[model samples]
Structures are given as C-alpha cells and as structure tokens.
Target: MKTRQFFASLAAASILLAVPAFAADSAQAFVDKAAIGGKFEVDSSQIALGKVQDQSIKDFAQMMIRDHGAANAKLATVAGEQKLKVPSALDAQHQGDLDKLKNAQAPIDPAYVDMQRKAHADAVKLFETYASGGDNAGLKTFAQQTVDTLKTHQQMIEKIAAGQDAITGATTPAVKTDNTPNAAALVPGANSFTEAQAKSRIEGAGYTNVSKLTKDDQGIWRGHATKAGEGLAVGLDYQGNVVAASK
Candidate 1:
C-alpha cells in the first residue's frame, strides 16, 4: 500500500507540476511562471479560435483571450513597477503543449478543452500559493486578484470536457458560464451590471439575436436568444451565469 501510494504521488506530481513549482520558490520565480503561463493561455486560445468547431469552446477561447490578455498586461505593469522582469515567451513545457494543439487533427475541441483544464489547475496552484505566501507585496497582491479568474477558467474547461464526453459523438460544449471579474451571488440579487453590459455578457457567451431582456425582482435578467442554430431561453444572473434552456 505504501509503495502504491508513493508511486501515485510521484505520477501525479509529474504532470503539469513544473509551472506551479516555479512559483513556490521566490518572487522572481513566481513572476516568471505567471507570465509564461498567461502567454500560453492567450496563444493557445487564439489557435482554438481558428480550429475548434463548437460554439461553447469558441466562446470559452474568446474569454480566455480577452481575460488573459488583460491579466498579462496587468502582470506586466505590476512587474515593471516592482522592478521584476516578466518573461516574454512560453517556456519549454508550455511551448510543447502549444505545438501539440497546432498539430492536432479535426475535432480539436476535446484536446483544447482538456489542455485548458490541466493548464488552469496548474495556474491556480501557482497563483494561490504566490498570493498567500509570496515574498513581495505587489506580486502577491496581483496573484491574489488573479487566482479567482484562474479558478473560474478551470471550472469552465471542466464543464466543456464533461459536455464533450456526454456522447460518443463530436465535442459539443456544455453550459456557458461568465467569469466576468465580479463577485455576485450565484442566486439572483441586485445586479450591478447594466442592461447593455448584461446583453454583452450574454452575447459573449455565444448567444445571438438576444431580445426581451427584463430583470425580475430576483435580479436575474431573462431574455430570448439563439445558439448554434437553435433558439434558447437565456438568462443572466448576478453571478454572470448565462444559462440557455430550450424554448
């Protein structure tokens, strides 16, 4: 039993451990890992945007591009202000992941989503550790702010993977959730997002022709919409949950 447990631990540590490993050592190490990992998210999502067919995956990729691009820029500013150099390129491991995605054949959505899930897990570990125990105040604060988005990314990828696996068919995506940098209750409540902002967020989740949007007393925005050639009853809750049900 001890031998089996020991090997299991080693095997688990062997996968995607390098990224988080860097962040555990020092402030400089954390910065390097964070920057390189952010680069990987943006670059790979750009590839997915071109190749992946599922609208959910495409929407997820778009979110990743926008969020990580912004996050990377924020990290750059923080790094410069703190006099730390952010790495401009993906390291060996991440570059290898990107190359694999590029070479993957049609129906790349599964591969892309799976890669995102694992990558985001590692990223969450790196950021959470740095946020709580890093050596620098500025970098720690950045990590603190960025980790939640990483977690939401992980959750999104997981749903994508599960949605794809629901059938032995093509990689159809699952539920589309908005991780739009905010802290609102999962249940409806006084929504802070404006009506236009709500529509934009819902549209960003891949719904189109959105109309009849009205906020209920519960603070959930309910509306009509279309997705993947099918009309859906769409609603946006305070927590950025853009749910689509059959009409």
Candidate 2:
C-alpha cells in the first residue's frame, strides 16, 4: 500500500513538471519565429544596403545585417544544442514583406522604415514573452539578452522615421532656410532627404497636406503645406528646418 501511494505521488509530480513543456510558445515555436524574424532583418537590410538613399536608413540597414547575422548564428548554435531546426529562409509572410522592399512603391526609405517598425515591434514582444515564460532555458536566456538590443533598435528607427535622424543626435540645416520672404532665395546645398523623409520632417513641424515637394540646388525641399487651416509654401533645408514659403 505504501509503495503504491509513493508511485502515484511521483507520477503526479512528473505530470506537473511536464505542464510547461506544452506551453503556448513551445521551444520549437521560438526557434521558428526567431529564425523567421532574424532572416527578414538580414534579407531586407541587405536590399536596403543596395537601394536606399537616406544615409540614416543606410546606416541602420548595415547594423541590422551585422547584428541579425550574428544573432542568427548564435541561435543556430543554441538550436543545435537543443536538437531544434533552424529555418534557412523567411516564412511566407516575411517573404511578402521582403518582396515589398525589393519592389517598393518608390521611395523605398519609407517602406523600409515601416517594415522595421512592424518587425521590431513583433520581435520585441516575442523575445519578451519567451524570456519570461518560455519552455527552454537556453532560449529564454537568449530572448532576455536580445530584447534590449531590439528595443534599442526600435528607438533608433523611431528617431529615423521622425526625421530627427542623425545617429550622432544632430542634423544640419540646409543653407537655404525655409520661410524666407523671398521664395527664390531659398538656399540649396546637399539635400539627402528622400521625399518621404522630407514630408515627415515637414509634418513633424506641425504642417499638413504637404504636396509637390521638390529639391532645389540649395538642397532645399520646397512644397505646399497647410498649417493652422492656412495653406502656405513650406520648405525643408538639408538640416531639417521647415518654414513657410514666401508667397
């Protein structure tokens, strides 16, 4: 009788220990999702390295390639130790995102920024969930260590998208300041902002309906924008100064 009761209790304990193994995000699920997300970062950034014109976006793409490439390798190593499979390519959904980058609707910079925003948000959530409640000890540790890097990336991209994009925490204004009384005098220098970035900068300065943006010789982006229910000419300098256009 005593032996039977002991065996019963032991079985119950074993069952309790096995419950976490069937967690919502299983070990292999983490491996798959992480692999897919990492692949997307590497592949999309690879495309950006070749096609993107924005210097900030270009620098970010380079970082994604270097960082995600290393993370992928480390994940593969960990997955191998756990006898899990690492996917070599992006999943169907991520492949679609990559396709958009490959053949974007023009001004691929915005597309890339949009894609990274979504991707890093997903990655940060995934890593946070797994870090705290994952089935595998190794993956949980990896997720914990990686979550901070992903969050930093998220902040960086937000700054870039917001047009406050100098990695060094500063942007130079164009030689031509916007809102000068003489629209023709808007000085141009070297405008590196894509249309999307220029629009974002203008919008960030509280303008709306920015349209017909064109870069002139002084590296100034001149466009029609509305402020306070007033339609006026707006311009952005290389340094990101947005001012009303002289009528």
Candidate 3:
C-alpha cells in the first residue's frame, strides 16, 4: 500500500511538470516574433542610413546594427538550444511594419534618430510583453533579461534623438569676424571662379595676398593663413562659408 501511494504521487508530479511543458509551447510564438523584429530592425537601419545625410543619424545607424544584430544572434542560439522553430521570415504584422519602415513612413524619417527611437520603443514594448507573459521558463527568463537591455537601448535612442532635435532648433548663426574672409567660390551651386576671381574676392574683403588656392576632396577651395604657431588652411565653401580654419 505504501509503495502504491508513492508511485501515485510520483506520477502526479510528472503530470504537473508536463502541464507547464505544454503551455511552454507558446514560447515558440514569441521567439518567432522576436526573430522577425530583429531582422526588420537590422534591414531598415542599414537601408535608411544610406539615405541619411546627417552625421548623428549615421551614428545611430551603427548602433542599431550592432545592438539588433547581437540580439538576433543570442535569440538564434536560444532557439537552437530549445529546439524552437522560428519563422524564416516575418509574419503579416511584422512584414507590414517592415514595409512601412522601408518606405520611411513608419518612423516618419528613416534616417532620423527619432525614427530609430520610436522603433526601439516598439521593440522594447514587445520584448517586455513577451518576457512577462511568455509560457516557457527559459524564454521567460530570456525575455526578462532582454527587457532590461532593450530599455537601456531605448534610453540611448531617446537621448540621441533629443540631442538631434535640439540641434535643429539651436544652431548659432555664424559670427562675422574682421579676420574672416569672404570666399563665395565654394558654395555647392556657385559658379566656377578663377584664381584671379578668387584672389579679387579675398582681397576685396580686407584679406591680403589670398593666392595659392587648393581644392579639397569635396571640391571645396582653401587658401593659406599664418596663425600663431604654423600656417593654417582656411577652407571656404561655395556660399563662402568658412568650413574649416585650421592648420
């Protein structure tokens, strides 16, 4: 009688364990969703960065590539370990998001840091939901850990996007100094200027002996200037903006 009771209790315990396992099958769904999200992030990041002209936006793109790619790898390893089957591609919802992102309509400006911030926000929310609600113990733990990381990334994106926004509204107008020469020959759409024309413009602006003009890689022209310790180069753009005045 004692042996039969022991065996019955053991069987009940085994059944209890099996119940959670069945529930954990739902983890496969979250895993698939994460994989799809990660892929869309990486793809959209690279493609949008290509169209972006802002330096800050370019830096954000690099971060997305690094963070999202790492997350995908970790998820892939976990999927392999658990024998979870992930989708080869995103599902309808994720695919729709990807299409919107590719078209720059989802984030409103694919190259902008705000776009990345919003995307990361969405990703963080998704991760949080799954991590907290996932059925599988392993995936639940993984999701919890990912939520922390995603929150950190979300903060970074927010900070950067905020900085970018500040830059938009906070540009200081260039102060015209007596020493700054007017060289209207380097603006993007400016007409060609001969050495004589450039020298005339420079000399007319209280500059002396503004000769020996050289062109930089971006087709901007520069003249030589002697500062405190050494001879410096003064790069002037087509609109005569002083791009760089350094040695």
Candidate 4:
C-alpha cells in the first residue's frame, strides 16, 4: 500500500509540473499564428486600398489596417513579456493568401470582400477557442477581449459582401439587417476623442460595464456598454458623436 501511494504521488507531481510547459507551448503557438494573421491582414488591406475602386471597400481596408496594426502591437508586447518568440514573417499559408489577393482579377472588390469575410470568420473561431479553453491565463484574457473586435470586423465584412452582391445581382446570401435598438450603424468620424477620452465620454453618458473598447483609424470607438439593464454596442466617433446600438 505504501509503495502504491508513493507512485501515485509521483504521478500527480509529474502532471503538475507539466501543466506550465503545456501552457507555454499553447501561448507560443497562439502568438505565432496571431502574428502571421495580423501581418496578412494589414499587408493585404494596404494592397486593396490601392487596387479596389469601391469607396466602401477602401474604407473597410483602411479599418483593417488600423485595427490589426493595433492588435499586433499589443500581441507583440504580451509575447515579449511572456518570453514567447513570435514569428516575424508570415507563414506559408498566410503568404499564399497575400499572393491570392494581389493576383485576383478585375472587380477586385467582391473577391477582396470574400477573402476578408473568410479570414475574419476563421479569426473569430481561433480567438473564441483560445478565449474559452486556452491553457495560458494571460493570453486567454487577451483572446477573450479581442474576440469582440474580430466579431465586429466579421460583421462589417459580411455587410460589405452583401452590399456588393446586391449591386452585382450575385446570388450570394444577403445579410438581414436587424432593426433592434442595438443595430445602429457606426457613424464613422463622428467623434474626435482618443480612446481614453472616449472611455471617459462613455462613462459620462451613463454607460456602465464599459469594456473591450477599441478605436479605429476613423476615430470610431467600439465596444460594450450597458444602460437601463440593456447591453449596447456603443461608439464615439472622431467628430465627437456618441452613439449606442442594440446588441
């Protein structure tokens, strides 16, 4: 009995020691993949800004550049603190995505929008998985916070795709616009507050539980807020406008 109990204790000790190693590995893998994805988004969007004739597509590409660039910076800081080595170059798969975007034929708006939708959809899944069950605590928090931003990007890209389909009479499924109170459109450039200022403004506007706030290049701040026991998609634009959309 003593021998069996001793062996069981040893096994438990081994498992305990292995947990951090597994977490570190998970964190490293996440950082590597996220770095590559951010680079791909920014680079491809830059290309699209120059190539796509559609104004809305240009706007979406600019938003991607700004948002992904900020996210990459944050991830880099976290990776450095965690002693993880994030890859400096795109992986082969992401490289192929970039190549595809660059070589896509005329009417590049639709193709570009399609790619953005798919990429963002994948990104949402990746972030959601990490947020829910990742071994690393800090990165898990980061993932959880970032998931909202990725979801917003996905929704915007889907809207663009649907609009494009409408214009071209394509059979692509149309996104139904919700008429709920939280479904208000973002008024870009409607506010001039920096992110910090936007937070203050949001608090002043009687929003509680404000978090996950992010500001795009157009000075639009997006995240969650609550008022009257209802969740809202709240934003402050560059033109100093504060607006809330129903969730």
Residue 209 accuracy (lDDT) in model 2? 91
> lDDT tens digits, residues 140-219, model 1?
99999999989998987886675455322211224334423121323557876568866776765567898989888888
RMSD of each: 13.5, 9.1, 12.5, 15.1
Worst lDDT 10-window in candidate 4: 167-176
Q: Residue-wise lDDT of candidate 3 within 1-247, one digit each (tens)?
A: 9999999999999999998677756777788778887887787678766655444455567777898889888888888878887667867865676576566643233244554666677778878887777777677777888788778878766755543443332222222354553333235544244455444433323344455787656555678644344344455444334332334
Candidates ranked by lDDT: 2, 1, 4, 3
Candidate 1 regions off by >4 Å? 1-25, 169-247
| Candidate 2 lDDT, 93-168, residue by residue in tens | 9999899888875447778988999999999999999998887888889898889999999998886766643311
Model 3 accuracy (lDDT, Cα): 0.61
Instruction: Flag clash pairs in model 2.
Output: 172-239, 173-239, 174-238, 174-239, 176-187, 188-218, 188-219, 189-218, 189-219, 233-245
Query: Superposing every Cα of model 1 onto the true structure, what RMSD results?
Result: 13.5
Candidate 2 Cα errors over 4 Å, as ranges: 1-25, 164-241, 244-247
- Point out the higher-scoring one by lDDT: 1 or 4: 1
Rank list by TM-score: 4, 2, 1, 3
